[model samples]
Target: MEGQATLNRRNFIRLSALTGGGLVLGFNYFLSSCTTEQGSGQAFDLNAFVRIDTNGKVTIMSPNPEIGQGVKTSLPMLVAEELDVDWKNVQVEQAGLDTEKYSRQVAGGSGSVRESWESFRQVGATARQMLINAAAAAWAVSPGECTTENGMVVHKTNGKKMSYGKLVESASTLEVPKDVKVKSEGSFRLIGQRIPNIDNHAIVTGQYKYGIDTKREGMLYATIIRPPAFGMTLESFDDSEAKKSAGVSQVLRIENKIAVLGRSTWEVMQAAKKIKAQWKDDGTLESSADMTQKLHELLAKAPKDKPRRKDGNIAQAFASAAKVVELDFDAPFLAHNTMEPMNFFAHVKADGAELHGPIQLPERARKRIAELLKLPEEKISVMMTRMGGGFGRRLMTDFVEEAALVSREAGNIPVNVIWSREDDMTGGFYRPMYSYKYKAAIDKDNKLIAWHHHSAGVGGSASPDSFPAGAVAHYQVDTHSYETPVSTAPWRGPTHNYIAFSEQSFMDEIAHQTGKDPVALRLELLEQAKNNPAGKVNYEPDRFAAVIRKAAEISGWGKPKAANIFQGFAAHFSFASYVAQVAEVEKQADGKVKLKKMYCVVDCGTVVNPSGAETQVEGSIIDGIGHAMYAELTLTKGKPDQTNFHAYRMIRMSEAPEVEIHFIDSKAAPTGLGEPALPPAGAALANAVFAASGVRLKNQPFIKSGLFA
Candidate 1:
């Protein structure tokens, strides 16, 4: 199955003449096993991701979904950089779902850039070499004698030049090189440069089309009424009044939800409210409080444990310690409230099906929709539109599946299923609530001697081998999980987001208890891991220390500050990247804690598109701080208490702090930047709050418990 999903180019390039006597170049990759050509009567199979026209215009297809991550611009930049084409002459188009031609066409886990860097650069380098080969032949010179610059190949000796368009026809006849040399890091012109997003004008001018802005001819709108709580069954419904409502077209049922279709979205939403549905749910539903209590009970009972890592005798180390410190931490469930609520458009027919929306996992959606419709994968087409935000929520295909099911039941008519803000907020699939217990011991010499952590949560504990695990001489990690009906999935950095808070905060507590600087303590642990490691350390200690040192230097970690201001520090490694943060917090006279600024250091190997990297870092910090300070979801009887933005507060502009991000200089293989910066922000802020107020916040949403008051 994995081999079938891989992308391979089977056919060579095909050249044709355009209507204006311009040359058109097409490269095709076979989608099926038989290697048959697609329509248009082309003899060779073609999957054109890059096309050069006679008019000196280059069009590149961005193979990943653009979920407000600047991938649409950054991915194409990789191709254009290697193609040696002028950025101005390039046009970027979003590719439809084509797993056969493009591998991993999704946009979650910050893998878009990391996964596509090599293949995309290779694509451009191969094309550039071909164009240079054509120019070298025309100039009666060796390929090495010719060089490319700004979309033109020039012979340095004679200064003879030819545009890429002029060589397309000749290049098409040549064989695709199996191995071409891509430019080295030092030779990169566009890769590291700060290029403006290609869609900036369209976005600022209100011309960009998001999922909500998509429209089709004769398309109907729909709104689904789901059960208020999980495990509820649709017992009965009365849609007679909804059918008579204004502009109401049809009232139907699909799966466990009832749908109201109308000519406009407003009409459908209004009609949905009028339809009365009777749901039958078991009375033994659990709430957030109940779940939290259950987790505590499980922890106290010492339920069956899955030991992740164990080193020396922890009991002996603790028993020989001078002092021991223990603490309990709890974090509530969270909701992914994307600005644009979950919406999708689908049209299913006996022959084929089409789906369009802001889906992060298009390939997965296509396969699932194919199975749901009882059709082959090739019979379905999925397209992605610009999304307001994804944050891992769009990774799920439930909304797309619902849209397809509704479209099929609605006489195969094109239908756009829209979820109101309330619907989206109250929907299932949330960040699972978690509870953690941490204990540490210090020896007579004030050296860390023992460490133990036990965690319990809905989806299981986050990565158990958290940082400092391999650094300690005697370390052990145990986890217990409780199965619940509540749907749970990855949220942003997934496990790292919550785990960083618990681990980093506890490390800070250890620092305070040992009379050591928090940043210095982490540095010492990293040094210990590098020099004399206890077990197999998964992270690079040098790289980890580099970021911590850099963040401390930039933030003036030990410098004295104003009376009301204090600093806190934290560092973490996630998504194959290392990040460290120092937060400056101010405790207002009224006891509210305010973040004044933050200094961040990131080491994601090599940087791609510095501007985009910075934007991602800044955004992740704000998102992290927002959730840590004010965002949380509570349940009452297995139903979300927060309905929309009014109740589910986000970080306001006034509350946002200045963030300074600096990346370590390296030419190593680049990793992801989207998620690594976030995990540390929560810990850094919490530690800073403690420094400012002389209080330890063991629970999330610090404001909920009047910690700020």
Candidate 2:
């Protein structure tokens, strides 16, 4: 708090004396959270992610993108919790892309907390051990006799205490502890407690700086004019007229698009519109109808290759079953529609490049920028800004690439590239349109004998190990993919977002056909998976069952309710977490269904920052429900028909239902909370609508299905 902390080496940890005595700690690991795998067994380097001053002030670097998922706050709590420091004395800063310093810095798939749980704790625990060692040396006592509490080292016998600040000088001279004990779950103070987001005040008071707010000296605003359609290639462009526009500083062509730079966003946008461009269709223009037909054809035929997962003889089971239920579910392409449109600021000097903006994958962006500028990876530095909203859009570095390209093309002038809402919506990288064909065979006793699922989509498919695979005795999963010019990427829960709706709704249909309760049916399947798993199970059946059971009990699953109100239930496992949701709907006087309330139960292991955890669950539910009810993105001749929010149709504030969230108490390591709750929301809502009315919804954008229209 009273001295400056500095890094002594490029990628090594060293503690040296400061003017007033400051402490800095560096941590490095090969753990990648992008997937379910743990450490890569690769060599590690040191990078400073924690710094403390002699005044007892602490600063921690949050190495993941915020994306409104609360990682900006919750991640730091992990370090502070292990350091035994007061939350009031801790401040968090966003870390940039540093391969030597951090791993899995990208924020997607809800892996931020899960992947860092142990490594971040080690950082604090190791530091705390050093401080205690220093205190014991000063007192001439055993290190084990000293403990830490609220940034202070205490001796139990004499009841003497010294602030961690006082031990900094001595700690700097001590050897690093290879293994330091971490606090038990029962001893955690800040983890389970309800702590507000670190940036709550700044976010609410209009003081937060999102990527769109990025500013630098002599930075020119820019916009791009891309081909109107996905399959169209730029043939020619005339920007002479655009160059005459006021404030239009420069106009240049970059690859397939033309960039217009000016003093203001409005001027650049207006000048970009004045450019005359010619696009030539490459005989690959795709329409929504084409994609739909392709999916239908693919789903209709069995693949020639082996199935992704096959447990038993599915054909024989279906032929011998008493009854077979078959259905098809469809979900259209969806755009991210982040509040702050894609924007990035880039300064590409002759020797190195500096990029500042909202990017979910900063390391990936840095690597690409280095390649584009023909510089070494170390020559490129990326600064991640607080994002307005990610939901997986910022994971693509197209905007960042555009800014860097424009900057370099404009003679190394710092430039900020901004996308209009229309541009953001029309730009590719949407949630791929998906279709699921499910068939279930039921025996005479109403027991499921077999399950068969076929999924077809444009550049996507269902998980082979997803639920019901290990529950049913005979099961098979086959996926078919079709190539398209339109680009697609992960959106929130990715495949689970649409697959959960289809899977859970079909389960509901099975219950309705067999005259059994829906909740009871799921429990029965979970029990089978837990006790006698039929195949490889990727999730904890017991933990999954816990959330399902808890949600049922809290929502009064089988109990009586008020008239005109119907309830539905759904559960899913994703991102190493489990979530079960119950939706309540009211039948209006005119017979239309309205979402009344939502009850969600989640088990992401130990909860860090309960307030932020609740916020994530609530936001996921609203987002899932909003998209299922109203959001839609369609393409006509490879061009998006909906270019802005008006045509895209987001959920209105008044339409958001009341939400009640419950988290199961657990000692398990914290998992992901950002996405698990979202996958089940659409399914729960659709099932609720069916109970309110005898309608079975199969398509997404329920409003278009005429149930709520």
Candidate 3:
């Protein structure tokens, strides 16, 4: 495959005059086009750019926010790879939300690398070509005779080389080339190599600063006391005792909550604990039992909305089937539980507002703060800090808004609003609770005929077009939703996270009931999809099959292993990437099942930063398994049951299975890796548990299924 296609005219390139002595190349090949500044005739937001200094140092600006996805390292590799620079000579800087200089700056959906793959490469290649043109001009030779290697422009005929830094001045004066060609796969040196994460050294040495560690001059620490439970509203508050506490400066009511401001976090926390607040339910206070009961009722009733997807006849196919099997799966709400919790620093004044903190959507946060503080967007500046963890929690700017509001309320004295672990767990948004009902029809010849999936949840919970849809002849998917006071947000893989488990586990059950090999059954369905697709296919069937086959081969599926060892397999496609996972479990003599190891195969196109990609896959698998095995959040009378680590369990190092990751070799453009590997891990483990115990787990948190001691 070509390294990159020819650039269109609309994807313009420009040479900017930098005050410092260096070559600066601004290029735009953005997936989404942003308007250029009026009368400037140049696209300011070029997606990415490269700056070469006189010291032979390369500074590449990363446009997107980094949330531990290793984009800080992998994205710059895209530029350095095409720039032909040695890894040691390159440095990366996180670009802020400069609409005129950056585009696609958010950190959600794992689109950072995928979106910038081609464009960033072009940015580097364009600069390299400019430098070669300068060298060719000096040598009085054709530009075609010059090639770049390790930051040097080489005259292949005379064996003469010129450092990029030496030609920076002449290169900056030259016109930007439009037809610059990127390197092919065979020429890649920095990419597909095991480059360590750029922040690894700082992270391990405790020198990296997260948003929670943010501090500003004259900053006051604030701890808010919002409604303790959902559906409740603050009736009144008495802050006389809070004001009497030592170090407590002020206690004021903001909206429905009281904000305790002090010199230190501990003081504010203690002072807030002394306040007397009364809350009353403004609506029906709900419990977990009530939500589960409502879910059952909705799934049992016919969906009011039209089916998300439909192919062939569903009622007739099941009615005419030789045999049918139905099963239900349930999942509970989960807290994000980011290590740093929720914190942001904001100083909102009449003229402008300065916001600094960790946020996935820095642009969105800036706009929200501007709207709330009644300031112009240009007047509000938002800077992103390295986050401790996101997991989709930072996508919501509520915490950032709270900090801005508190700062404004505190007389614009630069306040940092922080949430305690309890505040984060009890009040933060969660993954919507879900229940799925799957029914499949098998023909007399034991061939799968039809599939009907019904899911009901607090919000949407089904991916209608995701696999099994285009594979089955008669397929239909319906979803039922109910509104509640509970808050829900996008978690890791979002809908794919839970849907894959239910869908893949149902496939395993069908295979067992029909006396077919699970792995063979999936491959057969994939073949059907390839040969005769039922409807609009959103994924590449060949790519999906490749991962499945690779996973089976690596796990030694259907082959004999150690005593009491059993295996289960699952595959899913999400974020434009395909992944397959095989879970290995050991059935102990005590009748308990232990997950020993996991084998994961991914086809995310060309792997950039092999170490980072492997780490992402491994972390995703561990996160998926941890949530599937132990995580659960429940409510009683609108109050959370578990608010801290002592009550809410996580997968420990002892319980975490050893994960082996493999990526398929492909020349296709790279895709997202942060989420694709997560969707299949739960299902693989669930299937393996059944293979060992002969008991099919139908609910989330397999630990609660009585299969483990």
Candidate 4:
């Protein structure tokens, strides 16, 4: 464990050389998800990491992180469909880090679905073509007439067919298809249908290895003690008492830090607590309270860091408006709180290093490790384990880098670094807190005349401002960012989730003021986008209205359903898909909002798996609801305030609402399903609560702001 030794590194998963490394390449895909395989002979390219073995099992080296968006199943579904393989017979393997194959494994900004779907399809189509070519040669027929159906190459006219497994050996010898025609929507047998998750068996049985479960022979378990505050380096450490403890191997200072290595993780954790690690609290000039105060002030004068969208003259219209209303809303920082804490296993070598862990950004982490370890790109091997829950938390490589650093410190010996519950919580990185200010005017005709919106926040520095102030007549959307030591990445719907709560709530207010129904008001604006127009809204007005109408029909809108249960609605277009949500809420005497039910309608063009899409949409609604009501990651004096499940909360089974999701029938090519439904659900819930209580909740974690009261 103390020397550079790896017994079965090659036996585990061998890497292949790359075909493309750095060329400005627009991603090309077929019927699946994203294109990742170009193929080469060397034993380590990222593309080669994705392979169809002679057994006909497709090992999709998932480039995207899988905290729990189900990319592990959905992404491969894209490939399996295009490959014309039986979804039941397919197997997906996590990929090692290889950017030559994966360009954007950084999973955030709701780009996972729209970006990777077609590309993965290309990989399948290419493989399918090769298989068909093999079958054609074997049957001595033209390749044109041979089509694929459910993992078999069928002589379409003759009805003779061969399974993918039967043709694997022959297919491997055929020239890979360079420009093969992908199957049309009408010809698909799998792309738009409901299918079970491929990895569901592994997950249900706990056989799914996460980053925490990664182990190696002669690998030492270790724990790290980082500085309490950002920008603070280790001043000194005393591990004499820890080193003498049972099961402890050696407590050595590596890279100006103290690392406790032991035989077991429990032992290392015990030894880690005894080590008196101290450092100067070199943090920002402001505390959490200080930051809060500054954020409120900044919300008013949200500096013009960037203008995301602007059209018409709000100032000119506001100067001559009848009535104007202004409001400010705030949201605190949030922690990912993945069921599994951050962990990684690495074996650093002089020539290269092999790393495996629970990480979202696999390709990026590999490159970061390759550079941080000071080895050639070819020497680094990064592998992914199924993530317990990603939620945009696993997209960073900080923990992976630390593991590699410690492995090199241990003389390039194989080591698995484990982060305790505390380490995982306070380790570093968070969703940035935010504040928003809004001002809108009502004309004499009771119509919206002017709109001005400014949003300032942290954690969103890496996110693109996605709201266009909704489908408004005269609108302006302004955005700005604040710098903090807290590292932040994408979280589900990112900015749209928060903005939806704010913007959609404001839309409801305007609708009430204008004597128009909430749904009617949205329909009017959507009508504008449909008739004359605005710029990009991935959502077509008719399509968006279709979901709203469909959800309204299912929700019994405008009908005498119940006196206590109130309904509210919101719709949004994101990640190249449109989703509309109608929420039913009932107030409780305990001052908590009980979600009675939620109806969601989605139109994402072609559904590869209708059942999968429905499940994802339901999960998204619950995910957004739980985070909106109870999830908040605050800090005190540069340290995390919540460390474990007891303090942090997630939507539990009994608390989750009955989510009914319906899909629209469409012939459009296909769109994404991962995150499109998340944003509007939170907003719709808030609106429903407002209708019930006549209260407009502005801040996140509605319970904190007395939404029920």
Best by TM-score: 1
When summed lDDT is taken over every stretch of 10 residues in candidate 4, the lowest stretch is 1-10
Off by more than 4 A, model 2: 1-13, 16-47
- Each prediction's TM-score versus the true structure: 0.96, 0.95, 0.95, 0.87
Per-residue lDDT tens digits for candidate 3, residues 423-444, read 9999999998999999999999
Report clash pairs, candidate 3.
Answer: none
lDDT string for model 4 (518-568, tens) is 888778777876775544544567887888788888888878966677888
Which is the better candidate, 3 or 4, if ranked by lDDT?
Answer: 3
- How far out, in Å, is residue 336 in model 4? 0.5
Question: Given candidate 4, what's the lDDT at residue 153?
Answer: 89
Which order, best to worst by TM-score? 1, 3, 2, 4
Those runs of model 4 whose alpha carbons end farther than 4 Å from true positions after fitting are 1-65, 101-103, 110-113, 126-152, 155-178, 230-233, 254-257, 283-285, 302-306, 461-470, 534-539, 588-593, 707-709
Candidate 1, residues 586-668, lDDT tens digits: the string is: 88899878789999999998787899899999999999999998999998887889998899989999888999999999898
The window of 10 residues in a row where model 3 has the poorest summed lDDT is 38-47
For candidate 1, the TM-score is 0.96
Q: What's the lDDT of the predicted structure labeled candidate 3? A: 0.86
Model 4 steric clash total = 30
